[model samples]
Target: MTSAPSVLVVLPSLVAGFLACLGLIVAIGAQNAFVLRQGIRREHVAAVVVLCTAGDLVLVTAGIAGLGPLVASRPAALTAARWFGAAFLAYLAVAAVRRARRPERLDPAGTASGTERASRRAVVLTCLALTFLNPHVYLDTVVLLGSLAHQQAAAWAFGAGAVLASTAWFTALGFGATRLAPLFARPRAWQVLDLAVAAVMAALAVTLVVA
Candidate 1:
């Protein structure tokens, strides 16, 4: 049984973890953009959200398990991830640019043609690549967050808070994106979105190569 005093002692750690994770993930990044696009398209939203949240959970757990330092020490591993991530981002940027050049209006019924709707396996794989291939994911979730978790009064509590934050964020981003469906009904809107995605992906790729 836990005492009230003990709960109080760990409250700060929990809050700190939650805020830290929320701060890190709230930014618009490749993963978030992908999820938002899927949500708007109403394709495989549940799977994408689940996979992303689970990925964060696994990475956060690994960090709490003290794998951060070990991973940080492996420069070769980071280099491999960086290059692969950069290549993937570059490819995605090109794809987005093409889409922007030839925009497609979204169906109001949320029912895209067979060609437009990507397979679940493909979406899952892409989500995995976006989550795992980026060295920044490891650096932010594993190395940086892990170090911060250890600084808390209760490390596991901090980890739990982090996981909760991840779950909440993905849930909101994936499910709440439907509200924008009306906006995406216009082909021009989609073009704008694809262009934005292209720019973001390209910038990330460049940063990875230079860093």
Candidate 2:
């Protein structure tokens, strides 16, 4: 027994959802790093984008569909997520720091298509782990988006907007990174990017633990 939301309310909800999702997903993280790398390599870029966008869509849709309240009701579940996510992020941060120290440049000649590369299964599995293992993904797409979506009269519309935002962001990140291939051709550039990623992961790990 609910009526449709007015155009004003619906438009605002859509914009809110889009902006919120963009704000959260735009943060540099493992998932984004993989996508950017694949884009730069021109290897399985489409697959990575589709996988990430699909994962986010499902999480956001579920959040809007009422999973958010159930998750909120379970404090223990959130605690477990926080612990696991913090641990994983810490590990990734350490790994990034280590990689930064080594700083191997991408092969300049490897930009062209090559038969010998990361297999489809390997790529899929890696992206899946990067998406699912991160508790922040759940917190952002589920808890945060869910809580906000419910505030709107048309929650489904909000979720749709969020999905669109995710699609746009991943597409851009995966496809746009290739344009920077020249910059990343240098080992120093790779080192700088890895160091920045390490910093971001470390900060996120601390935030998760303290949150």
Top model number, lDDT? 1
lDDT, candidate 1, 169-210, per-residue tens: 999999999999899888899999999999999999999999
lDDT (tens digit, per residue) of candidate 2 on 87-178: 87788789779978877666646553322357889888878877887776887789899999999877887888899999999999999998
Query: Model 1: runs farther than 4 Å from truth?
Result: 1-5, 108-115
Which parts of model 2 have CA positions greater than 4 angstroms off?
A: 1-10, 108-119
lDDT of the structure predicted as candidate 2:
0.83
For candidate 2, the per-residue lDDT at 159 reads 88
Give residue 30's error in model 2 in angstroms: 3.6
What are the TM-scores, per candidate, against the unseen true structure? 0.95, 0.83
lDDT of 1 at 33: 91
- Candidate models: Cα lDDT each: 0.92, 0.83
